[model samples]
Target: MQESDGPAPTSFPRPPNLLDGSRTSLRQILWALVFALTLPAVLIATAGFRSGYRAERETSDRRLQETARALSLSLDREIEKNEMVLRVLALSPAIAQGDFAAFHRQAREVGLASQSRIALIDMDGRVLLNTRTTYGAPLPDNWRESVLRKMQETHKAQLSDLHADPITGQALITIDLPVVIDAKVAYILSAAIGPEIFQRIIADQRVDRDWNAAVLDRSGRIVARSRSPAEFIGQLANPNIRDASAMSPEGNVQSVTLDGISVRAYFSKSPAYGWTFVVSVPVTELAASFQRSLFWLFILVGCILLGVLLAAILSRLIAKPVDRLVAAAQALGTGREVTGTTTRVLEFDTIQKALADAASDIRAQERHREEALARIAESEARLRLALHACHLGSWEYTPSTGAFEASSQCRAHFGQGPDGPFCYDDLIAGIHPEDRARQAEAVAQALDIRSGLEVEFRVVQPDHGERWIRISGRVRSGTDGDLSLVGVSQDITEQRLADERQGLLLHELNHRVKNTLATVQSVATMTRRAAEQGDEGAWDAFMGRVQGLAKTHDLLTATQWQGASLEDVLRSELDPYQDAMRQRIRLRGPRVNLQPGAVLALGLAIHELATNATKYGSLTLPEGRVSVMWAVALSLSPPVLIVEWVESGGPPVTPPRRQGFGTRLIQRGLAQQLGGEIKLDFQPEGIRCVITFPVKAVLAEPAPAEDSAERYAS
Candidate 1:
């Protein structure tokens, strides 16, 4: 019997077209236009509503800013006027000269006119005159001494914040005016203004609605408030209020929730008192008009959208079944077998027959299943190869049996032998002793918390070598509470070694450069001291000594500071005068390295001898020449390098009468650093100097360049 290659079917019948396809085209077009118009209308309406709301908010913010600025300016003017009044009182002839009767009479007249309390206070805190009493009351003892100290020290008018006066039992702000008599402060005239006046000014500035204005002292205590004066007048500052006051001096507006209602607030600082003033309006009230406008807009748009959606649903009921049948036929053409059964409409019945025929035609040509399987296998094989090349490995854990199986690459990463048992303990044993405990702890933490794992540590290779390995894993948990850890690890030994070498080289280079800078600073200091103590001749001699030290460094750098080669050193110092000799410079030596200190001293000695030869010795005339050579001692207990400088070309040579700084520096400097001796030759042909130094450092192996690849890969 032949197997059937047909799809089993459900009880859906093929649908028929209720309306002709040609007749319904115009209806579909009309409905499509309807949906398209409604979508844009909704988006445009939303955009328009937001724009209108933003404009309203901007206008409100501008009005609030303008009002706040005007109020602040007016307050500044009033405070300044009061300051001027106190200044007039301070300079009164009677007050400065201590004519008590005239000062008292003037104070009373001015107090009544200004409706303020005034008093005269001397440096000793004595009240000499009072405006409000039959007999003058003594100055209050509770007033801050800093205010008085300021007045006497600055000799200027000062303003104080509102405070409760113990003497008068009323809240008052005082202005202290300094009385300067012949450059000495005689007294301060104090004017105590009532707190009520400040309150009235704040009240006039208040906008209707739930708005408030309050002034806070430098210590953040409320001195006056526009709303509910007695409730918060002397209270400690609110947390949000205090922080805002400290940050800003210019007035600002913000929103905060107070009493569960979000409030929009404006704040400013008083230049006169270092005081912060805050005004707040309820955000709910400010945005009420905006919310109402948005509410009507949304209602209108929502009604229109609802009507369109209803009409679309009716059209979908008739068109949906036909769409399904057409889709089934298209699916068959694309090599997807369709059951070809639908009952959405009558026209779809015809579609069912067409789809079945196409399905058969397509089946004859399709090799989709076989091709798909082959492609999948090829992709997986390529993936495996790539993972092996890069040394990457994957793992899976079965929580059901608490069994963990890692890939072959993972086993290799841990340095496990090829046919050995692969388990967690074997992996742990491969970790370097120093890093073993850390890696173990990380793994344990991951397992305990049922979380992911990541770790890097050195692995002790089987050959007694070490390699760095990085391991990462994730936990798999079963529904029954069992958990298994799975992860991967790869070798990173080469990278780790490169990083370590790079770090070491950087440290060594920094240390050497710092030492050179310190040496230069010391030379500058000694030269300056010498010049300070000596005459022109002494200063010039000191400068010449410093220049000779600098010359050594220049020669060392020319050799890349790798170490000086003896023959290269001689030619560097002697080549300057080669034009005079025309053909008289000769050098012979095998390459040898010198320490930086040894190279510097030897270069200086060569420079000094060359200078002498050029000026007054053999090289003074045209026929002078120098021969330099060195030979290494291979048989000595410790190796030694010997260099000889022989000059023979122009004039006769002689030793100097007095040993100069250059002579002493070269002979003494080389002997001190190299533990060697220098012999100066005053030959008839030219001047020659010989230097002998141990090769203790030169015989040691030179340090190789460190690998830096780890840095780039990281």
Candidate 2:
């Protein structure tokens, strides 16, 4: 047994060729091939699954964010609407007058309309009126002291945190506003709405069956929940939700629910009320499809293992044909025509033919794509031309990149070069200095609300000229997931100028109407005084004077109130007398234009003189005659107008012992209105009168065509 320590007999192992012939070696080689293919296939499948899951998760998150944002916006609108109602009620005169009964009635009406409870409280939190109760009914001892205090301090509308209402014992929030009177806060107005309203909002915005939505107050208390509102109302939200809500005003988060369900959640805070809205979908639902994919992955792995065994068996027979087919497919993929490769295997030959057919189809598709691009370009060109013709310019601003794109007309409006890039700052710079801050604020508000922008502002050009522009736009998200504003701008300078002119014309018209009313009143009073003094003919004389004034107004109106010619005024007043006694009257004037005021005064004076001539001075007798004439004295520094009225060929003329209303009107009213002097001479032949006034107040050029047409018609 101590045998030879030197060496033991050694047996030689089989050579490589001998081992290759054995079943064990063949089995080992098959196993190695299966593992080599299976490992990479599994790795690729796993990577694909992971990537797909990540994409799905991100999509879900974005959808949840949108839903949350929508819900929050809806809540904010409701709250703002309620606040507006309170503000309107606060502005009521009854509220200012402390007419509690009347204010209560109105508040109750508004409450019924809005489906909410309205309450009026004093600074000390004492309820003065409550719509929830009968008129003059006693209110509960407890009031929303905190809300009242906040509204009083802020002097603006304030929304309260969630609390149990004293009347209904339901979770409610109050929107409070100060009732201001005499520039001081007199009382507080509150609109209390239950959480059930927000619950309805959540119901409307719910995404799907598996999704949950909840609205939370500033203190993290659940005010409303899409599911189990009765149970969750007034309760603190889950810790994770509270933390996430505290972190940001809007975002996505992954967390577990109180019931231990994983979820992807999104939340947004209301800008008006500081309430948070949450939308969540169960993570398990998202994972269900992923689980099914994993199941298929395992089955695929088994099939791959079986295919490895068959592949090893068929490897030698089809190797050359498959290699040629692969080479041909590679060439086709590289955009080269497959011409030379040939394969004897039926499957390989069929694959080669299919590859060649696919290449042809691809070339045809390429041609179609090029044609589509050309059409798109043509359409864009046409759109640009249309915008330019309309004097409208389109623009886009990407906030993330601070990039701005503008049409040619838009650049021109901003006084920018056509070739250069312009940004938000450039747009602001182009705005007039007076309007720059206001426009910036408008844009900021639009962006914050994600709403349309409509503003009219002035833009200063390089030459310092101002042009009014109206910019109207809407907020949208771009393809790259960035916020963008797209809008159109239009030149409105002509429109603004037209508006100003219209305003001036209205003002002038108002002034003229007031002056005419005063003159008519004075005439009526004077005539009434004369009639009271037993002059029965004064009424008829007054009517004739008013008619004279009306005739003068007609002349002025025809000329657009610019002025009236002295000749026209005289002719209009004396036309009736001239018709009655054609050869008895003579009128002469050198186109002397009279201001509207002067026209009224001088027309009345001529009417009085003609009346005297018809009644006694000259026209009483058929042979009697009268002459009226006017002339301008250019020798004076500002020039002067002189009008003479002479009557002749009548019975003996005598000065009246007592001045009548007509004589006084002719002397005093005419003098005061024309800012000049008047003389009345009673000569034996007839009555003679003279008027002298500065021509500058009653001088104008020839009327325009339109005015002349109106004058001829008058």
Give the TM-score of each candidate.
0.37, 0.39
- Model 2 CA deviation exceeding 4 Å by range: 1-391, 400-412, 415-425, 444-449, 478-483, 493-514, 554-563, 575-587, 613-626, 636-639, 647-658, 673-675, 681-687, 694-714
Give the residue spans of candidate 1 off by over 4 A.
1-409, 417-421, 432-441, 466-468, 476-486, 492-585, 607-625, 633-640, 648-654, 695-714
lDDT of 1 by residue, 544-605 (tens): 54565566667667755666655555666666666643456666554555677766667667
lDDT of 2 at 299: 80
Instruction: Provide the overall lDDT of each model, using Cα atoms, as 2-decimal numbers.
Output: 0.66, 0.76
Q: After superposition, how far is residue 423 of candidate 1 from its true place, in Å?
A: 3.8
Candidate 2 TM-score versus the reference: 0.39
- Which residue pairs overlap in candidate 1's backbone? 15-345, 15-346, 16-345, 16-346, 16-347, 17-346, 17-347, 623-649, 624-649, 624-650
